[model samples]
Target chain A: MQYPEAIAKLIESYSKLPGIGRKSATRLAFYTLGMSDDDVKNFARSLSASKSDLTFCRICGFITSKDDDPCVICSDESRDQSKIFVVENSQDEMAIENTHDYHGLYHVLNGVLSPMEGRGPEDINITSLITRLSDHSEVKEVIIGLDASTEGEATTLYLARLIRPSGIKVTRLARGLSVGTNVDYADQLTLTQAVNGRTEI
Target chain B: MQYPEAIAKLIESYSKLPGIGRKSATRLAFYTLGMSDDDVKNFARSLSASKSDLTFCRICGFITSKDDDPCVICSDESRDQSKIFVVENSQDEMAIENTHDYHGLYHVLNGVLSPMEGRGPEDINITSLITRLSDHSEVKEVIIGLDASTEGEATTLYLARLIRPSGIKVTRLARGLSVGTNVDYADQLTLTQAVNGRTEI
Candidate 1:
């Protein structure tokens, strides 16, 4: 039988999310029905509150509470202002931060250049990064830490061309075989990068 | 850096879902952040509406809009009242209905007996089913269409014992190897069931 209107609507809403298909959406909607009233309210409230309550950092374009405009990273005095890591999104920034090797600040591009999808440099937060760089001469290095995709390469090239004229050093995350990955399973591109980026023993 | 309160809240909420992990939850939260304001509002509205605007069918214990108290299936005159198919939840009922073979009514048990999880016959909608059966007197066959889990078996046995005393024919879904499944790959229990439930060609 067809789901009731409310359940169907919720399923539709869930299916619109990334990585969630119609079947998973239906499962999720049914799971929601089993949730307590308070939990359901909290879940719904969080969905709306996350969008309406948070503000983007003015400098880094990272998400932050409305009261903290530049976000914790941008506002913190301990973070190295001399280097800025440019990433595709806040999740990427978080991933880099989790590594604990980089103490530099971050610039969230929000998305990469996907011309096929009508996503140009203007579509993302590139302008903010450019403005931040131009306004602050202290940022000596701009590290492009994007995904290993066509859009990422295009965005990196675009950013390099734009930032190179300003005398700022531009770099990218090393594209090599990832940790715990078997050499036999490594793709040709990764193998090539691993050989190209061979470090001294 | 720590996620903003709103983003963190959303991720936590998403992670609470059955199949979603922390990484998937984070991805979903980011996707939510990228959603248009109207879309986000609608999503949140749908979540709340699905919880608040839906009610359980009084007769069958199935989910339905608040206005449709007995639900479509329970109220429909075309359904064969002589047979009541018992399922663990609304999703199971939907799955059975999708097959299109069952023209009888349904009785949602809401959940199966799981002593480990503190769920007993008293915890679910079994009492309502029993009440419906006794009051109606038309339900001749009670089909238990629960999952092939230990909990499902226990519930089915319990239900069979309860209904047999009332002189009602209690049946279960035929358990065997699934269609198109290779016999070699089938589990031992499934193989056993397949052998036991063998039919004459």
Candidate 2:
């Protein structure tokens, strides 16, 4: 059956997102149609605004709204800069931040090492992380806070092999986190447990 | 955690939809940020286009992109004007059309009768439906194709009580369809059974 071109277009856009199927997309489109004109305008405006407003912090690679070189995490004096926890993405950054247990700063890798997905050490911010380590001798420990996936494991191994010779302590989040679970999906208690039970590599 | 105003706005817009939680909205906002400029433009365009391009058919209340006074269903020579099935929304029209079992026309109520929500016969297209019936003397049977919900039951009773006085046969889709299931969610076989086994109201 044919739908209005506008409705069809809206449904198509909604379906483009991850996990949203055609039926769900159509429902969303109809829901939007029922909304007021102001709401629809706000929805459209936000779609473009998110891309233009948010920026990756230059110092720590964490996503932040500020245009300053150092994000809130990097600039905060109370946080422990000596212990840097490296994560796979910004979502993990939020997860860890929610626990209020991690007083250390974060370095987002953007993605894990995955040869199958054509992702490698060079493709990520590994070189920059190494440079940061060399430049900042005060950093005592480097915690690999990546997920428990195959790529997370490979990246941990690669990072450990590179930093072990530097005489800096390299650690990883504990195995308390279940296999196949992404760091973003983990609950606060599980993430806290993993952080507290970290093991030296 | 402070997000950029634009990102926050985007997340808020996504949270307005049904079933989408804060986390899902954030994920969607990030995904939208990663989309290409053309895709973003297309999405925005689709929203406005659907709203502006489609018009509700005056005769049947079905939304159509056509500029014609009566929509395809109302104007089609092949369709049996004598048999009209009334539905609550346009999606139900699609569900019935998918089966291709009925060559009859449709009448959309825009919504079901719900006194609790302050919706009455006048709030929907009930008046227009009455006008259509009075104007079309050739019409033989009127089928109420509403869901088995409280509002649907109310609308059916209201319509049955009103239309029975006109001396024309009034019928409803059969009891084969399970209660609380929307017509759009019903399978083809179940919908077919409901349509074929229709009884006098």
Candidate 3:
């Protein structure tokens, strides 16, 4: 009782996506079948267009249109170029930018150093970041805004060791219990950081 | 601080799918971008191809390729043409086929009677089913294999009322508590059906 070849192929394609299992994929395939021909074309086109039409920003590694190589953040003159926030990827950059508190430009590393996963310093987009820092003497500080994971910590230390020798101030995102998280439920590492990094009210 | 237009479009498309929300869509969009160009093209091709290449079986309403008008079940000479299992959609038809117990042909109603949703008798693929029964005097029994919803009950009653006058037998799936379900935890309706439909071993 196998499904038709088209349905089976579409289900397999959908199942490749994160968080989608075979059952969910089947549901998606059936739903796609119900869509109008125009909608189906647009849906399929978007999958390919999202990948082909976008490219990494040459200067910052943030994703942008193929025509915008330096990206909007790097080209904007009003942003504080002196404070460069180095994040793990474009999504992290977006999350930070959404806060609207940091008016500094960003540098996306594309990925963190994961030695266990065979991802090392060379695997990520680090060379361009170093070159950007050396080229812009106005950039006085490098803020490592990576996740609070082992790989993020390793990447932060690795970048700090490299950038600090050039007389540039190096810092990292403040580690503490997240806002809206109950103190009782906070993990041990976060609680310890919150205690150690206590500031005046 | 918007995601690139292509990325945003892909995310929107993923979000439109059932069971996927904004967070899941974002994750899927990023995963799609990470896929190889050939894989992405294949994935997109499957979406459009599944929609355009497959169509409804003209006789049974089951989804099939364009060339298979009557579908595999309807055209099979070995199957019992005298008994027809009426289901809501192709998914149900597949589910029933998976059991490997029934050898009768199927008639897909496309949808059940959902008057609350403004769906009437004409809204679903019922006309063709009635025409098939009228055209084939060999179909002596009609088995309603719809879901156990109020709409399913209404549709079963409606179909039985129409086909019973033709001197054909009309039956529905047995109603009772499912196997392995805890009797203590069963809902009132199921418990009631279990009591009413109780049988001796």
- Which candidate ranks first by TM-score, i.e. highest? 3
lDDT of 1 by residue, B1-201 (tens): 689888898999999999999999999998898889988898889889987899889889899999999899988998998999999999889999999999999999888999999998799998988888899898899999999999899899999999899999999999897899999999999999989999999
True contacts kept of each: 0.84, 0.66, 0.80
Interface RMSD of 2: 1.8
State the weakest 10-residue window (summed lDDT) of model 3 chain A: A34-43
**Model 2 whole-model lDDT (C-alpha atoms):** 0.85
Task: Report the lDDT tens digits of candidate 3 across residue range B55-121.
Answer: 9999999988877777888889999999999999888999999999999999998899998999999
Pairs of residues clashing in candidate 3? none
lDDT of each residue in A79-101, candidate 2, tens digit only: 89798899987778888989888
Which of 1 and 3 is ahead in DockQ?
Answer: 3
Q: TM-scores for all candidates?
A: 0.89, 0.82, 0.93
Give one digit per residue, the lDDT tens place, for model 3 in A1-201.
788888889989988887789888888888998877877888899988987899999888899989877799989999998999999888889999999999998999889999799998888988988998889999999999998888899899999999999999999988887779999999998999999999999
The numbered model that scores best in DockQ is: 3
Query: What local lDDT does model 2 show for residue B91?
Result: 85
Residues A69-98 of candidate 1: C-alpha lDDT, one tens digit per residue: 978899899989999999988888889998
